[model samples]
Target chain A: MEVSGGAPKSKVKVGIPRALHFYRYFPFWKKLLEELGAEIVLSTPTSKKIVEEGVQMGFGELCIPMKVFYGHVLHLIENHPDLDYLFVPRYVAEDKDAYFCPKFLSLPDVIRILPNVPKMLNFEVNVKEFPISQSVIELGKQLGVGQSRALESYKTAKEYFKEYQDFLRKGVPVNHALRLVQRDLPFTVPKKKSKGDIKFLLLGHGYNVCDTYINLDFQKKLRDQGIEVITIENLPESLFKVPVIVNKRLRNYWRHEEEIMQAIRYYLTKGRDEIDGVIFLISFACGPDSLISELIMRDMKVVGIPFLDIIMDEHSGEAGLLTRIESFTEMIRRKKRKLEMDAKKKVKSKIKSEV
Target chain B: MVQVSDKTDGSKAEKEAFLGIDVGSVSCKFVLIDIDGNLLTHVFLRNRGSPIDSVKDGMAKLKEAVQENEELQSYTIKACGTTGSARYLTKAIVGGDLAKTEIIAHAVATQSMYPNVRTILEIGGQDSKIIILRDGIIIDFAMNSVCAAGTGSFLDHQASRLGIAIEEFGDYAVKSNNPLSIAGRCTVFAESDMIHKQNAGHSREDIIAGLCDSLVRNYLNNITKGKDLDEPVVFQGGVSYNQGIVEAFERHLGCKVEVPKYNVLMGALGMAILVRDHYIDNETETLFRGLDVSEQEFKTSTFNCGDCPNNCEIVQVKMPSDENKVIARWGSRCGKWEVF
Candidate 1:
């Protein structure tokens, strides 16, 4: 319905490419779009065909996630021809003093290269220049809503966005979190980890790491090995408040780098006992991640914690990934077992001496 | 007194053994170890690119080796372990109690022989790994990426290009007095550097020696970079046979690199030890399909499942003798058909 008069709402079909920022910021945008009389159309979950199409269509220099994101756009264009508009947002900066990757800055331009693409409902998100509220109201106006209603929609969506984050803060899976937050449902506490279950602090970007296809079902594979995977996204936001090692070369140069840098520092020091090992997953050829992963590896090594660095690319074979992960888990198990045996020997020797 | 592996009483002297099969990218090995953890018989055979056929050949050789020893003729395999690139496939073929990764196997074998080993450099066919250990615990490890720069296959390619037998490749390295310098970053660049040295009038022996040094340099710079390597560094794997690389590593690190007795077969050896300890501790019945598995017939094929857009190529193995009973099915993202 119209806010200015009794005109009927069009129920405009807006296509959302389920990638990149989809893992983090999709909730707010989805809520904002749906409440503004537009039906949301999400691209399918990532599959091998999508990845293969992306790898073939994408340029060699682009990272794996970018290729995957491009694949999602092509998928929406080709599969859902009924889509009236494609919602490809341009992410310049989420915070002050740090910017998104250049890939994010040019996402909309890159996707528009394909022929016969839908009209883009592009939302330029640069909080430094103007508030996110302004961008939301602008996007809502594109969907044919009044400014007052758009501001209310933005406020309501902001609350839903926080609900989404709260679910993630409780260690819910990204997909489940989105579904739950949409329905306004409660998230149950995850099952308690057993005594023998190994805890692995998995570190990576939300998009690449959480995407099962990109990381080769990384979290599921870890659970298969009787391991409990804890990502930086699963931890509370307060964990990033401390003064870490803070080396200038290893500081939060990128916007999301703060989470990774801070997570490693916490695990290596105060929260060392919270996990048994660290598995860092990185996209091959990612500029910021290349440096971040090296620092993570070095920090873990210095503390003598068992660590594994899995570099994922388009052709990341499942066999190699499984082998590395299995070996790391086995190593932690044997190391703990050996320490127990040595402790038992010391007690036995002390008892013999007392006798 | 060999720690967890030799929990069995060696003095009892029972005719029982554990079997281990390692199917590598270029070769396969089968070994039998007694309860005392001593190598009873070992058969290292080039699989000729087919792991299944190689396992059959290895079994025949193992049987022949056992026939020569009167005391080992009636030995029973209490446990069996499989490892290497085709570990899961080999485990499915021969029916193994467990399938462990190569890194863990190498570390276990090295630690058993030299319990104080702080660093281990293992270079096998198609793979090379640097493992850093502290007090019998592996703290960090790095495996060669999708590159073949400093692996056994890389050296094998060069050795053939220079008209030298793979076995004699190392002897030439030791004979050369003046080894030329070559880049060790990429296989293509390393090959080009070798050609350049050859055109520049370097001796074959010197170039071969230089290749060995380049491989060692690659390992130190790429694989073991930023990691601490303490004393008692253990070097093993198929590549350890190259005394040239051994000398190169020793010279670069300024410390002695000890090659274990079963350097070429450590993966199989550690697997056997792991299987043995696990069998004894758990008291579970051995999953080995018995000695007749060598004679069993199997059919292995891969087909893409058109169930969805993923089109995953699933590997299916069946026992031909048992009315095509599906023995193992894997290589699928979603494990609906997987038995292993």
Candidate 2:
């Protein structure tokens, strides 16, 4: 939807990188920028050149997020420099006492170190602590909209943002998260659904799970297994359960660790009666995920259930992944038979002993 | 009933026993702690080349000890808990009530012994970790898995190279009044510095002491970086038993660190305690198959799934019985393994 009654759209285009936090927060940005009378340009998927350029522009030690963000910005500047500036939101906790990881807080600073990037624009949104409305208003004013006009645009854009959220949460199997943000309801996009012979759960960092281009063959391989794949977004949020032991370790973070634990717990406990097996999808170098995956393994052992830990990297080896999945599915099939046989044996033994 | 076992003082009614196994890469420790946390029998064996054989041998010794003492034979096998890297393998060998991560087991065991401990510095055979606790809750911590500069395995490697048994390493370090300089940032650098110091004619004792100092320094720099290490520190893990390292820690931090009595078998102890806690609240039969489980044969293989970009590599362990059963499955990041 195009914004109307704007004092002519700003000639300069704004660049948005379709990476990291882009999948979730981009719509708010796209709608807000458009309403503020600014044009928007989002960078494409991360590739060899993008990653290489990102590494060059940022501190050598900068984490993957910063590296990927730099690459996206570099792509925009080299390809579409007509954009007035690059928008990189520095989301800080609204309450001074509340804090984020040093990495998230320092992201904008890392971007500043890059060479020949667009004029970077940023605004802090402490979602729970700060009134998001005020932050959006101030950002609108900074983009040259009058106070009243900014407020009106912010209200209109806020409606669009809610509509966008309701759209994506529907989990229509379309690969593009951006399109989901455009409509008010779950769009009947052609989904890559397979009436699978095997059903598997996909667990991982939100960025890796939601971004299709990062993990190229995610849907196709599942379709091959006729495996019905389930992700965190598909499940009811209320069904997530956090193990009591994990609560202490997750106290500082914004329920991210809790959400992961909850997602796994929900699937394992509730889906056990429905699904065939589970597969944990994790990033190669993610720290918190490595630990969480270990915890899940132990949980599986205790419950006498079977599971798998599938780690993904930028250079994900398809051959390696295929072999692991094949074996795991085989193992699951074998275990199901064994469990059924054991149940039958118990009944036979009880009847014979009674006689 | 045969005479009650020494591990169990007829002080508690309804005789029940727990098998605790801590299988590390370098060493495998097995202990039978009674319901009251009293040590009944314990075995510490080098992991050598095979974890399966070590567990079998340990279980055999436990059987012999129980049988030899007529009174102890009355106490039945109740439940078991396994910890460490090879705990999964050990669990497969000895079917039991629960399996837990080494971290949770260690933390639980330490908390039982040092309830007031604010920080736990656990440097095990292959890895090192720092666990912080406040209000009896784990607050924040870090584990060093990638590097071996501050781990017990590195110390063992250096001791063997210097032609000294690992047992003598602590004594030699303690004897040195002036430790020679040794780089402990990495194994290669530390070995080179030790060789240089030896060629320069430094005493073995001094060099060993220097190595201990370097290990302590590396631990402080890497594992304890930016951590709020508070007082009432409890140092446990296999490395905690090394007096030389303990002394070096004292000198470095200028604080007295308390080492729990069962430092080497703390993970197993923690698992046992968790089992006891979980069982006391419920009435259920222990799934433990007794000593005969050690005689079973098991095989492991790996395969990959091409279903998604996250190609999960799954590890499967097979057990042979009248029925060939696929006993355990793991190694998918998604719930793929669980669904299977």
Candidate 3:
């Protein structure tokens, strides 16, 4: 598949392991790599065999997602033996307060230690420390591309990435947004509808929430229960623009944690009436989540909003999770009924007194 | 029974009742409640790895009890709800109108009885949990399903190992004046520590008390590490009946731990209440298949679908009366085979 953009003399085969930030940033990397005249090869989706292999091959203490990442790397190596380079970016920081998890920052180094792994092409994308454009130019230099051609491709990729983010903000799930970007389809936001009887905001990282296999298709389960499911990504940009942490002590240093905390704060303060409950879905053994979830739990308690924290791992059973979600929705529905009854009682009392 | 007698007599009245069943890994519990949330009767049985048999036995006993009681005979089971680990399995078996998690079920039951309760400590056969509440609404909760160090089964194994009756294990611990400190981080370590204490000539009472203390400590450190444990704290589930653990929790938290009369059956009670409320709100006929399900023979089978790279292992439950029809299907990633 050749395009009109300045084509390389020979098409370079680029291997992209389908794990970790791939769920979130695959569009940007894919568009950029294809524009640079490269063929993208992705590892297969995670499965039982992949998880077992990952568990056997990886450190016992490493989180399940990280282990799954290793399995994908192995898959890519086994399947695409002739690939020129494996693009494993060193994602240091995305926002000022939102830093990548320690595992993410050290992912490239971790994969490099694996035996017989192919050569990796990496660029430092620490928005806090350096410019992304500079990283792109450096990456292009390593890929043997001209400066002007690389710069143009980077601009096009950035635009596509921005559109992808916009779609996420408009409530399009990550996987669907990636598909839209890959197919060059026009971006259309799902029309907003009246909120259902019960609404819950699911807070978690994009990978844990979007991966159906990893989370056991939690979204579908919630939808089946006739409850509206909303994610942090569904919130508008304005909700995230204002700083939620007024207390200096509670200010989070991690980039994603800050975003999550901000969205939670927005829901508790401004969106309280619109939301019935908040469910925090975190991967087991996630260091950042272990700390951040505690903070969110404390804050949720103070706000008096119902909250449920579900930890998902390879061993997470589907029945247990469903029961929890079902009960939570039922409890919310009961609370709503009581509130309506109280309101009606007050109205009846007022009418009686007037009469 | 006292709570049931307190309600006004409806001698000639045809009252509606809701049924709740909690089928966990180690036990099965059933509760019957009236519309006003008065517990009519409850039964708890050890599952012994056969939830279907336990549920069927519980149902048969409940049916017999209802038939024997004049007041209960007039009460119609309008709705049914199921909860716990085998919620889906039991829900299918009973044709339940609603299915919920044990967490919600316990929280609802506690909130109904003690509106001001801020904390709930539930320890079942295989799992333990700490649920934080505010204004009768569950605010935060955590369960230790991954570990066995703090669950009821661990205590049962230790009791059996010590040649003491599980029922009398708590009394022995309560008799101890000076409880020794035993390692409680892992079950195997704790078991070894108990043996060492015994070999060192420590009294059985002290060792048992120490075991209880260790389990409580492990629970606080792991499941409820950062949770807010405000009072009034209500402890329930099978472990709540163990006075030794209750004392250990009370001593550690420096607060009173209230154990409800139907502590072990709280999940079933909560589910019944949920179904009662659900029926009232929706005003639709319940999907209950009736107590006759106890006599039916159900079958389950699973196969891996090869249509895609996902290869999801789809589980199908065949209904008893209808042999050819699949009552429910799960474990499919794409929702293609999910008949329910």
Candidate 4:
């Protein structure tokens, strides 16, 4: 395979699975690994057989994403044996503004339980507590890369990562005229507009939106109605400004909640002008979404912004949803019409007074 | 009132109805029964959006059915009962009735249908549970909701992946003789295994049948573990319609599994029957807010309840037409918000 920069082959190779947080942070890992003169091999989109082997390896009760990660690991061991070290970074939290669930924090420990594999290398990174230089040195030594080489690669990788991230931070142009702003991207994508169309913002965790069957064609129904749906996953992590004092003390804290809140706060401040309404799609038993959604919706209601809270579970119903969506949409449409009519009337009156 | 002894009389009372609502994570069912314990109207709708909206629509459908039936309108509803995940929210919406667990409702309904029901295997849209019964009483039960493979949702997901409608899953199951050994312990493994089987040149039908088999196997291993499952086993819930699963259970258990006529609505039916029995002795006002309640807006909010360290966040849904009333309260981790 031809390397991007035409660099010579490296002695050490690392395997990364393009799943879960990998979907969110592949570019960062790629640049970092390359700068450190290490070969990076990422598994393909999880195929059926790989997922099966993964399931067999990762024992009982692990979530699908974790299983997918395990599947990728199994694929690496089976297909590619040239790896010097299998690097699985141990990420607990990014900052006070960003945190991951206990599931992610314990992933390395869980993966270690699998039968047998190459030398496992893990680097713990948490900006709030750990020093980046120390973590990089530890990671380098584990991978058989000397301190000098590892330190230089770390600096280069961090710089390149920041540069690439900047591109994502600012809005990207979808076409010549339209811009796809990530910060206000709704969870649900809108249907193609004809003449007049309504738009709605859908907020929730990525897992909920990505799991289509569980959510029951939430996007399809909205598209059927020619409504534009927005979600949080579309937003760039950089565009989202962390809230002041965005720390929590809950034992079971949802890592994504703060980011969701940050994105929502940005959208509520700016999205109110661009979007017609917002809908918070929360899970039935998820404690964090319940609290965060309530807090956000309460604030929205006070501002006279129309917001709807949808709690989804395994038994989501069709007729009830249709009726509710119809009602909520009808309310929003009527309100918009009323506002337009009132504005038109005021303009006509002003024209008559000038005459 | 006919002067008769309670034991002698079948206690046939007219002009009073009972409402039973099952608010499942995947679906919501409403059943209205007359004092005679006859099923008058039933509303089964998919909970595609919100439980509150779905339940309200189900209530509206029930109202329409009642309006068309003269016998249903003649009697006032004596009581209302709810079951399932959203039972508390449903109870608050319907008001003033017994709120029972899904296990109790399922058992009660199954027992009423087949007096000799030994094992009750119920798989709904998103979750699955096995209730072992001895002499018409639940001895031990196990349920798993966090994962998808052990439930009907897994089938729905795999069906969509195969580009087959959920209704057609059973027909494909019948056609496949050489089924692949697909894993169904969790959604991830099952999905991965399905892809691998498909890639390995297995027909979709064979893979689907394999999946059906694995689902049944997982259910047996996780739910019916160490239980004395015997003859006359009954299958209930939406998953029972999947012929693949039903046949799978029969094939695995080596016995015919009986599915009742009202298997899908059995829980709702059971709750309605319970309500009828609760109000059999005395006349009481039903907590049902009438048919017009469907048109009213419900304002829902959640606040961290400062009462304890659990901070047990309480979700409050205030019904319209009441200035100083909170119709429903839920979302308490400690069951504190479940106000009857």
Candidate 5:
């Protein structure tokens, strides 16, 4: 809430629509903008009306998340006409080999053409072309901030972002970690205590999994059933550093896909004994997910791990999803019981032979 | 089967039986089974958009059947389970001991009948599903509830349009030697294609057979896509009664498709079995309100809560005996008004 840069008491308002990468990188942007003395304006959370408006504005065949993003942007534009600028970042690639999905890379361009939109403070965040620090500096320059002031604010935002990532690595949920970051509270690593129940690894895009309305409160449903769910964002950064091994003849260059694959590999290689099953959540008609899910399914089959793939869209009903999750958890629990019984029987036989 | 004694003494011993009810959008089904999982009696009725009335009528018929049979009279209902689209509403109405989705109920019943069943093709009135099993465990499944081209209701509509009874429609399909090819992607397109074939002077038998083949094709293309379907497949639900569709599945898969005697009542039977298992494992008393629930008066109403932007329409059901007391409330996103 503190406006650091001293130009005017009422700083320039920057609208940040809550969609897509908002869940992942909002803290960094918010901190940097505030440090550069800009007031942040966020759109309302996703709802039925927002989605309906988005559907009317968007053409058919776009993914639900993308449509929802458009709706959020429209909401911000319509509600906050007094906003000075909207921050729409173009994220082309995160790593050298892995590029973002086409939707993410072209999001700024897609929103630029929408009618009745306010001025946009667009900057490139591609590592190869324009690094994040450079993008932040350019964003500051657009707001008439000095280069030294922008550099200092960017360094402070980077430190906060790193702290937020550390919280995520410790298995805290993204939303909860964001609150802690906003409150400027120290991150306390959540202890991993085994409750002697089935543990499932839920893998999906940050937007799809974190958005309650989009995923139909999937995490709460699982937790209510006493099933422990660990999401891909909960995995340590070191896990993502491991190389993803697809087929020698094929390559998957999507950054999100690579992150999910690395998490799956980590669970399969080291956390197999701790985890009971894996649930791969994907949006309907997602091209990247279609291929990544097939590869993951094949790999899971080879590793002999229990897996469930749930595809969601606007038409996804909650009853069907609950049924599938119930059956899956029951199956895992039964398998775990059988394994324990077998172990007990083996010990009983050894004691009888010794006697 | 156990025989009833001739003695009419009131002190005669009573056996335990579990009741299962399936309140679907199109039909309501009821099943009664003994503690040993033996089927006692079952009833299937059309829903007609009133689940409460259908459940009451089904329960009344079930009570009459139990009273008419001497052997069934010896058994007392110990527990009740509900499944289907209206499972939650039916569970609250009947005070069910167990409630589960149709998928789990159908899978459990099929597994009980054929212990080694690896795949199950169930086509109900409004939806169709393919359940994949391995080692008596369900691992994967898919349901095509969005489309009507592959479900039983579409076939019924087509049968009515052709002025043929749904029961006899299958017989005509079986008599056809060479079935005509019809598009099966969408229901509207398929209907137009069927009419066009009729105008082209194709025999009714071949067209019906072609319609059956089209439905089977749609089912396989949509529900079973990317699935590894193994042998010992069991096809059930209301659609399984149609021999033409059964033949189409067998011919398409190049394997035998087994249809149990009580195929349409599998969901109810599965719930009965599950309730029996739950009772035995937990050693708990039954939650069944009794046969008198058929005569009870209940009311349901909905109100949209404006507490948040979600504007969730919360449903509240008033108990029959006490109109002032709301028995159940749901449909809230934040679980603020949920009471059951």
Candidate 6:
């Protein structure tokens, strides 16, 4: 209300907490905001100090991820005092049938109760009844931007977002993909380097899997060991089509849950040989991920493909996690070795009969 | 046995034996196996809160045992492998050929004896694991998470509280006609229930028997939930020494559960088997430091790394024989101080 949202003089500063769906939608938000002439600020990546402060400030009832978001919010509020507004979007439903967790739908109001908070830029994202542009226009009106101009910026941002997704489908990591897209560099897919003979499909929420401090850089650790670590976002989104994943009898109404199940189920059936094992990371902080992981575990069990479910709460001991992962890879290696030997044996017998 | 450089004397044949050390939270084991898979010496020692001491002491006993044997003269440790909670630490101290997880080691040991083993229930000192195998390969495994109900430490505590030695627990539990229902969801709840049963005029045998039943139920319901427990089921680890718990597993699965002869030393045996099988065709010299490590002094020190806010505790171990140089460093979350 005190200034023009687009002007360079006293430019509006919008703070985005680095948690939750930040990994998924940050690039799109940054593109749209930059086009609309607003500056953006982000909380730093999660650290030990931030996590401890978050746990102290957060109540016992809130889940670990909620506590993490609280820490990021506090970081943004305390670190960036010149912030004009905090962008906490109310994400309800991504599709016609799927909705987000209640925390995402309700956390904006919850943060409002915190003392001495900056003004919040609350936007609704419900793709079921409206397109994302409709939601953007409503937010644009609040920011004192013309609807037509906001619509134009939205279209351009949409293209940028699609390109980013294209990079993801090509197996470029999210961080590198974001950099390539944000810098508006010449488009070229990075060549795929085959590391390990084995592939592991890592399934988890984007926030849990992408947060390095939360998971102790587990994916990279696996990659260093020559195991090609992949996530749902790394593959084509078309794998989650209604015909491929959803049936009337078996469907998950949660958008994130549906993605996780679809990715795992894809590996279990059509892409069974694409991966040697599956590692589902579950944050004990969130109940839904655990429930969905159990369902995925059963499918992996029936197929006899190796599957390991690791749980992380406020803090997890690395020793236990290391042991489980080590043994799991060992099991897969032995199984592969035995299969090759058996195949060789069969071929040799056939050759003997021909001779 | 005739492969030694000078084989004229059978006693001086330099019998090739693999050394396998398993250092868990509650106990440590040292095993020696000849090339034929015959166990020469198996030593199980209580950890007593320090696995370093257990390893040092266990090695001493193994050396004395080997020297005392009349047939295995001119003894030489060909290769060494480590498994269990402190496997990495043990490897650093013992100069092991490889460090493998207890799950893999246990699975290998069981399938070597019973090739068709489908399920393996291992209740050790601080952890309990259930491994599912098919066609002699490990498929699925789960460790007891978030509780110590099925572990040996809790059972030992309960036995001491009831004034009964853990080794004789089976004798008392077998006499119970009606076992009391002890809580098995957690150690805290189980301890309180044990006290209440003592006050409620329940016999000691009944309480002990009830505790074993409760532990098996908790393991199946929590850790191995919905896991298939097929035939040729082998039970190993320290808990297999207790007849009551073994019988409880047999009853719970409604199948015959076989406990191998070296049940307590299966992890060590498995590691020995693994290293031997892996190096069977290779000519590479072993990295084993030999049994002299037991006579040498091991110096360990822990200091908080003040580099960051995390203040990770970095532990470093120095071998006095190696000019008192640091051998291994651990306990840093960032892996900056990792030396092994």
Against the native complex, each candidate's DockQ, computed on alpha carbons, is 0.70, 0.02, 0.46, 0.02, 0.43, 0.66
lDDT (tens digit, per residue) of candidate 1 on B162-218: 999988999999999999888888889999999999998999999999989988988
Runs off by more than 4 Å, candidate 3: A1-10, A94-99, A127-130, A191-195, A238-252, A268-274, B1-17, B34-40, B66-75, B111-116, B132-135, B225-231, B280-283
The lDDT, on a scale of 0 to 1, for candidate 5 is: 0.84
Q: How does candidate 1 score on lDDT?
A: 0.83
Give the RMSD in angstroms, all C-alphas superposed, for model 6: 3.2
DockQ of 1: 0.70
Model 5, residue B192: what's the lDDT? 97
In model 3 chain A, which range of ten residues has the least summed lDDT?
A1-10
Order by DockQ, highest first: 1, 6, 3, 5, 2, 4
Measured against the true structure, the TM-scores of the candidates, in listed sequence, are: 0.94, 0.57, 0.89, 0.48, 0.93, 0.94
Write the residue-wise lDDT of candidate 5 on A50-102 in tens digits.
Answer: 88888778789999989998899999998999999998888898777879999
Candidate 2 residue lDDT tens string, A191-262: 665467656667765566665545545655666656777666556646544333455555435344456677
Where does candidate 4 stray beyond 4 Å? A1-355, B1-14, B305-312, B332-340
Candidates' lDDT values, in order? 0.83, 0.70, 0.83, 0.69, 0.84, 0.83
Number of the top lDDT candidate? 5
Query: Among these predicted structures, which one has the highest DockQ?
Result: 1
lDDT tens readout by residue for model 6, B1-340: 2122222344565567777889888888888888888888788888765677788788888877877776665455667899998998899887888899999999988888888999999999889999998887788899977677768888788778878898998778778899889998877888888899989889998999998999999999988987889998999988898899888889899999999988989999999988777657574577766676678788999999988766778889998777988989988767789845
TM-score of candidate 1 to 2 decimals: 0.94
lDDT of candidate 4 at residue B117, scale 0 to 100 = 85
Error of 4 at B94 (Å): 1.2
Q: Candidate 1 DockQ category?
A: medium
Model 6, total clashes: 1
Give candidate 1's error at residue B322 in angstroms: 2.6
Q: List the candidates ranked by TM-score, beginning with the highest.
A: 1, 6, 5, 3, 2, 4
Clashes of 4: 24
Predicted structure 2: clash tally = 46
